[model samples]
Each structure stands twice: as C-alpha cells, then as structure tokens.
Target: MTLVSTATLLQDAYARGTGVAALNVITLEQAEGTVLGAEQAGLPVILQVSENAAKFHLDDPGPLAAALAVLARTSQVDVSLHLDHVTRTTLLHRAAECGFSSVMFDAGPLPYEENVATTREAAWWGHEHGLLVEAELGYVGGKASQVESAHGDGVRTDPDQAREYVAETGVDALAVAVGSKHAMTTAEAELDLDLVARLREAVSVPLVLHGSSGVPQPTIAAAIRAGITKVNIGTITTIAFTRPIRQKLADLPALNDPRQYLEPARTSVSAVVAEMVATVGLAGTQRS
Candidate 1:
C-alpha cells in the first residue's frame, strides 16, 4: 500500500478507543527527533507544524513542508505531515495547498456562530481537496498570548456545545480543553476526566486532547479510555528531551557538533515516544 492517509489511521484509532500522538515540529532537529522516535517505536507519527512555527520561518511553509515530506518518505515508520492550530485563512489555505494531509482550523477565539460558520467554510475547502479537517471545541484554553479563548473566557467547552459544533461544522476531529494548560513547564497539569467523559457522550467525531503534555500519564490513559482518540503531545516531549540535553551539554563542555549531544536527545525522545505509544495503545498497530 502507498502512504496511509492520516484521516483513515486516526479514524481507526478512534474506533479502537485509543489516542495517537501528534508531535509538533518547528525545526529540522525537531523533525529528525520526532521521526527517530517513531522509527524507534515502529509506529507512524503525526508531524505537525503550527501557525506560530510557520510564521517563525519567514511566513513561508516551504522549508518545513519540504523537510517533513522528505522525512515521511524516507522514515521507517509512517509519517503524516499536518498543519496545526491555523487561524488565518491565507495560512490555512497555504498549509493544505503546500501538501499537508490534514490541518486544524483553530476558530476557538471566534463567537460560537462565527466559529461554526468559519469552520464549515474551511471544512468545505478541505473536503473539496480530499483533506482532513480538525476543528477546535470553541473553548481553546492556553496561555498562548496570541490565542484567544472562545468558550467564554476561562470556561471550557460545555458538553452541549461540543456536539453542536461537530454537527454544524462536520469536522473530522475536535480539540477539547479539559483543564490541561498549554505551554505549561510542569507536568502537574490536571485533567477533568468528568468533562472528558461528558464530551465523549456528546460528540460523535474523534475527540482531541490539547495541552496533553501537562496531564499525567494515568490521566492521559484514563482519557483514552474515556474516548479521547487523539492526543497533541508537545510540551511533554519538550521537557523529556530538553532537560536531559541541557545536562549532557554541561557535562561535555567541549562538544560543539550537534550529533554528539543530539544523539542522546534523540535516544531520550525515542524512549518517551515508545512508552507513550504503548500507553496510548498505538504500539503494534502500524498500518501497512
């Protein structure tokens, strides 16, 4: 079989009541590290480049896009490139047109009606081009200065809104904030399992848990059991890889070449990915 479509793989995971980790990549190192992790785990990993990352590369998607495509083709495990948390129409279109298999249109800052309408329009664009659409729960919770909160400031998604949003927008997946905080340095972020369960009962499409890094492993596993089909993993990997690398550099003061230090970083990240994939029940489930 040719490369597996992210939509199909994610849907399968959703059906199996498991969550797939989507790692964010902003640099070649991040891409390499992520692919190495997946290769080590013997599983395909979703390679996501968020709007912020795209902007950092001079408002162009070419470099990151090209790198991921090359990695996807060469990597041992499947690698699906995705554009995450897009807000601008131009960038959203650019992402899909630039060769993303799927993209998330983050309308979490818009009014409920506007969020639905905009997402529907975006979803149509995605559908017309045979791309998967991932929409937010309209209650994006995080400390990102640029990201606006939509589910009414400080309040997370009420279960009813989730069902209505999915029905109205026809999105393939939904990102819900259930007490997990984004960009949190600590791994102590607690998740509201009750809210997650309510959302599971309320929405039919695959449920996405954002800010997932902050939540503990058991809580994340509990969320998987509670019907979360996708887990967005960034910060966890950040802490897992970075902290150790920093210590390594301090130990080896004369090492200038990246390979010397990054090797350990890659190894560390791969271990984390393997455990996470197993914990999320994605191991031994690679599709042909």
Candidate 2:
C-alpha cells in the first residue's frame, strides 16, 4: 500500500522463486502508468529512472523522482523508486537525495579493478545513506559508448568473477549478462539458462537481468526459475508508449492537445506493464 525498499522486493522474489519487474520511466505518465499497472495486477513493482532518462530532464531527475515517490506512497500496491544504470557517483548520491529507495551503479564498462573500486565506494555510500545498491559485473550494452555492443552477444557474467565482485563490492544485487541484448525492438534474445543457474549458485546476492525487453515471456519465467530475481525492462515501454501516439496523431491530424494522444500512449504502457507483471508471476502475489 506504500513505497517499499528494493531489497525487500528482491529478497521476496528470491524466496518465492519469482522475478520482480523493474520498469524504466521517462515521463510522469510512464511513472504513473507503471504503478497503475502494478496495482491493476495486484503486484509490487519498481519504477526506475535511467541515466539517459534523467539527462532528458536536464540531468536533474528530482522532480520526476519526487513525483514517483509520491505515487508509490499513495499507490494501492507496493512500488519503489530506483535509479537504473547510473554511471556517476554524483548521480547515485543525487538519486538517494531524490528519495530513491535503490540504484543500479553501472561500472561494468570500466576496467575490472576500477569497476570494483568504484562500485565498492558506491555501495559504501548507499549503505550509509540507507539506500540499496545494485551493480553490474559483466557488460550489458545499449547505453553510452556501449551502444555498439547492444545487439551483440553480451559478455556473460562469469560465475567466479560474480562471486568475487559481490564479495568485494558489497552490492545488494548483481545484474548478470546472460545473452539478453539491450534496445532490441523485438523479443528474440536467447538466454543461457544453465549459466543463469550457475551464476545464481555462485553469487550469494540476488541476481538481476538487464535488457529484459528482448526476452520473451516464457524465457523470462524460465530465467526467474533459474534464479533471476530482478528483471529490468526499458525498450518495450517506449514501444508501447509511442505506437498509440503515432497512430492517434495520424488519425486525427488537427489534434492540438497533447493529452489526446499521450493519454492513449500512457494507457498502452499500463497494459504492457500489467502483462509483464503477470508474466513474471508477480500478479496477485501480495507483499507482507
């Protein structure tokens, strides 16, 4: 009935053998729709703001984050605010200041040592600030200079390396790369279930799957069963949010009010989110 910690959601999913859906939002509509969808499905969800999305708001996501925090507090189901794929330490601190319950500190593109050092610092800051920290160990593309590798076979998270990374960084959750490519327009990424299970066993922390937009429904369920507790979805929300707007614009050329088209797009995103929640087996699963 109110905002909860990301750690609670992840731990609950791990205990239940299910996946928690973490959706990326750009606008307030997306944020509202994400929570509305979760409420409709009677499931708890995480509303995330990505680094690129924050840049779109002029590098200050405070307003949007505050809005999401309010929405979570007033929602009928549990919802949490999280910063996704953050590359800078400043941004991570800003996110916590903005009332975010958790953040994914992205240092996977850096050298292993540098990444470990930076992530450790982030985890320390997060813990001190009362925020849950999520960090990625292997490369999962589709942002910044990593765009070139967005669609390529991602560097799978090494089991041994993952164990060490968690032990050294003290991250609350670990996002693993297991063949899911970011920014995919279609759902066709083939996941390595065996690797997922191996990584789950190797790492003591809960596992996260990035680029989940490219993963189909059945595959997502299978990945969850194999030990993925958190699944991050971005591209599909954009697709769902834009398709109706384009269609409405084309159908009504004289429509001057933005709400006329944007409202439909927001509704579409809500439908997609509800569907994803159900697919992740979170629907109707009440939180204690």
Candidate 3:
C-alpha cells in the first residue's frame, strides 16, 4: 500500500469513526518498529515525535523525518510523520520544513488567553502550509511539560472553558483534561466516563485524551465510544518496548549490539499497537 499523508489518514479516521494510532518515535529502531506494526496490522499509523524527543536528539528533527520518508517509500502501509506537544514557534516551523504533516501544539499550561492566542497563530501557520494543526486546551494531570509536581496535582479541564477554547482556537482537534495521567506504569487507571460524555456533548470538534497509556484498555475503547476520535498511547508503549530491553541487557552483560535487544522490543510495541487498533477501530469499517 502507498504511504498516505497524515491529513488523509486523520481525516479518514474522523470520517470513519475510528481512532488512528499515533505512536511516538524516538530512536531509529522505534520508527522502524512502528512502521512494521502498521504494515503487519494493515493500518495507517502516525509517527509522532514529541518535543522532549526532539530535544533529546539534539534538536534534530531531520533523522526522524528521514526515517519516516524511508518507511513511506519502502513500506506497504500508510505512515504519517507528526510533531507532538510542541510549544516553541521556532521548533514548530522547523518541523513543518522537515515534512511533518501535522503538529499538536500544547498551549494548555499557559494562561487561557495566551494558550488561545499562540495556538491560533500556530494553527494559522499550519493552515498556511496546508498542515493539520491540533491544539490542546485545559491542563491535564501528569503532562510532561509540568514539573516538581506530578499527576493529581493538576487542574481539570472545565467543559465551558474547553468549548470556549475550541471555539477560539479553530484547531483540528482538541485535547481535553479528563482523568487519565501521563505516564502510569499500571493500566488500572479508569477514565471519567461521565466527564468524557459531557465534553463530547459540549465540544463539536474531535476530543483527544492526553494520558492514554494509564487508562485501562476497555476504558480507552469506551472513551472512543464516548466520542474521542484521537487517542495517544506513549507511556505504555515505551514501557512495553523498554523494560524487556533493560532485562535482556541485564541478563546478558556482554550484549553490546542493539540489534540483539531492540529486535524483540519491536514485538512489544507491535502487540500494544495491534491491540489499540483492534479495540479503537471496532466499528470503523471504511478503509482508504
């Protein structure tokens, strides 16, 4: 299958009523593995490079873009490169230049008015370049941008404020604060279904759950049923991919080559991705 652009995949997901998987890609192996997962599952997946990952790699978005281009050229599945949780205007512009089809601007932490203003500008820039722009409103617990305090210490997104923000920002999607945290090791966290339904009734644009990994799999599916069109899974996939690598390296002290370890880790990422695709896209029958 030809690699479909991010806009087509996202729009198709919205139209088909399924949540497309947007997996975070950090290292070269991760990108390859995500592409493999999408190919194996026959689903179009988005390769998301978050702001932290951008800085982690010395502010070089080039490698990730190159990696996606390689995947797009070679794979039989559709793959879209995306920039996630970006706040800096300079970095956002850089990602656009590097061939990102979409960017998720996280202005939720700032003052309400400022969040709207900056996000609007970012959206305008993205629209000018024909890129899909997603803006987040209301602060959720355990966002990576926050420090010194963890989840449960953060503020929840008010439904009215979310409506106002979406009305103000004109974003393609709106990430709202429900109950899930950012990086939970366990999958026992339950989402506020009532809150989700309320927001669904309140906001017209698609709703995005920020901390998806912490939420239970069933709750995640229910969130989709509750009208969430985009679900982001990062922490769970990271833990699933990394813990085994840690163990494999620890067991084999002389293991120096990453291929010996990262190969099996691909299976871990694929397993979680497969599950997400199966669960979220249950009622979604249309395919591009």
lDDT of 2 by residue, 131-161 (tens): 9999987777666655355335546788999
lDDT of 1 by residue, 166-200 (tens): 99899998988777767766668777778888998
The estimated TM-scores of all candidates read 0.88, 0.94, 0.91
The better-scoring model by TM-score among 1 and 2 is 2
| Model 3 lDDT tens row, 136-244 | 7666667556532323544666788888877887888888777777777787767777877788788777778777787887788778767677777788788878977
Of the candidates shown, which would achieve the greatest TM-score relative to the real structure?
2
TM-score of 1: 0.88
Q: Kindly provide the TM-score of model 2 when superposed on the true structure, using C-alpha atoms.
A: 0.94
True-structure RMSD, every candidate: 3.5, 2.6, 2.8
- Candidates, ranked, lDDT: 2, 1, 3
Model 2, global lDDT: 0.86
lDDT of each: 0.78, 0.86, 0.77
Model 1 weakest 10-residue run by lDDT: 279-288
Clash pairs for candidate 3:
none
